[model samples]
Target: MATGFYTHPDCVLHEMGEWHPECPARLQAIEDQLIAGRIDGLLERREAPLVAEADILRAHTAAHWDFLSANAPKSGYFAIDGDTVLNSHSLTAARRAAGAAVAATDAVLAGELENAFCSIRPPGHHATPGTAMGFCLLNNIAVAVRHALDVHGLQRVAIVDFDVHHGNGTEAAFAGESRVLMCSIFQHPFYPYSGTENPAPNMVNVPVPARTGGLEVREMIDLTWLPRLEEFKPQMIFISAGFDAHRDDDLGGLALTEADFSWITAQVKAVAQRHAHGRIVSCLEGGYNLSALGRSVVAHLRVLADL
Candidate 1:
């Protein structure tokens, strides 16, 4: 089976501002590169449906939902936090972005697809159950994990986050949960500085120093993360694929590159093949510089699409 490319139109409609790095142009960049690279032939494309309220409730509390829906601006932008914002179309886009992950997870686990990629935003892995921060309105992957366990009856799932910034929200959601194992590497002393402290037993937090380059990433995966994941023998794997760690991106000062992204994807693919029958669902998290972001995503997706 082919990999699934999950996305939605509303994802392009939501914008924080003209100057935001998480602009709609980010989507256009990936789309243009995918077309230019002729990647369309390697995957199965599908439109993301709006996630049901029941699915959303799996990760977010009812009170949190009520606050965000009630505070959504009708005509202009409203700030959810210092870095997070909501426009008129934010709610719709948030739902669809989350739904894309849900669809990808379903497709991968149900044998409809070998693997899947969700190309939507505002990027998740930052929003917690009660708080929406770091430009994230809803924790997309967290919701997908809940759906997989609660809805699909999967026992163990692993989430691998490689964002330049720590996935504080995802960690918050599954801190004590034994069924889910989250292994991640992020820049240290960065925004939302919480991962450096005592992490949950199942959470493996690798805080790479700024400018650690791709070599360090590979070492971490080979030495720290991969072994734990293999021992866990998770039934499914989810990735928070972030490109901001690329050398060209100044967002977090990490020195990773496109080749590094491909290498990481290959590692994840191997892990899935070993433990989960090649079941994997990856979602976009962050990547700032347009040229770097486009190239990094292409490299990552090339592995996912098996091209």
Candidate 2:
């Protein structure tokens, strides 16, 4: 089976503002790159269904769900935080954002596809169980992980986050959950700084220095992430595929190139092959520099698609 590509029109409608880096243009950039390269032909595309409330509740609290649904504006934007905002379509978009992951998870777990990619937004790695922060609103991958665990009864799942900033919300959501193994490498002293400190035992948070490039990331992957993931023997792999660490992006100071993204994808694929029957579900998290983000995603998806 081909790799699955999951997305929804609602995701594009969840705009924060014109000036926000996490604007509709990010998805447009990715689509432009895919079309320019004719990359869409390599995968099976599907529109994401809006996730049921039970799916969101699997990873987040009822209160968080209620707050997001109730607070969605009828016309203008409502700020969730200084950076995060909710517009009229925010709730619908959040549901589809999470739904893409759920669909991808189902596709991979059911052997309908070898792997899947969710290309929706409000980028989800930073949304906690009860709080939405860092431009994230629903913790998409967390919802998928929970669905895979509860609905599919998977014994183990692994999450690898390569965003420049730490996935504090994802960490917070899965802190004590032993069923999942979350590993990440992010630039230290970045926004919402918390991963460098003591995290839960299930987390392998590797904090790199500013301007750290592929070599350092590769070293961390080899020396740290791989060993833990191998021992855990995860039955599935979930990726928070963030490209903001690219040298061109101003979100953080890490300097990863497209080649680095492909290299890391290959490494993660090897681990999945070893323990998970090559079942992988990847979701977008962050990437601001349009050109770099577009190129990096092509490289990452090329690997995920096994092209």
The residue ranges of model 1 lying beyond 4 angstroms of the native Cα positions read none
lDDT of 2 at 116: 90
How far out, in Å, is residue 251 in model 2?
Answer: 1.3
Q: Model 2, poorest ten-residue lDDT window?
A: 189-198
Assess every candidate by TM-score: 0.99, 0.98
* Candidate 2 structure, TM-score to reference: 0.98
Question: Candidate 2 residues 1-307, lDDT tens each?
Answer: 7888888888999888898899888888999898887887888998999998899998999999888888888999899889999999988998999999998898888899999988889999889999999999999999999999999998889999999989998898888799999999999888878897778999999998898999888988999999999999999999999999999999889999999999999999999999999999999999999999888888999998878
Task: Compose the digit string of candidate 1's lDDT tens values, residues 1-307.
Answer: 8989888889999999887889999888888888887896677999998999999999999998898999999989999877799999999999999999999898888899999989999899999999899989999999999999999999999999999999999999999999999999999889878798889999999998888989878998899998999999999999999899999987888999999999999998999999899999999999988888888888998998789
**What is candidate 2's CA lDDT for residue 79?**
93
RMSD of 1: 0.8
Task: Tell me the lDDT of model 1 at 22.
Answer: 90
User: Once superposed on the true structure, which residue ranges of model 2 sit more than 4 Å away at CA?
Assistant: none
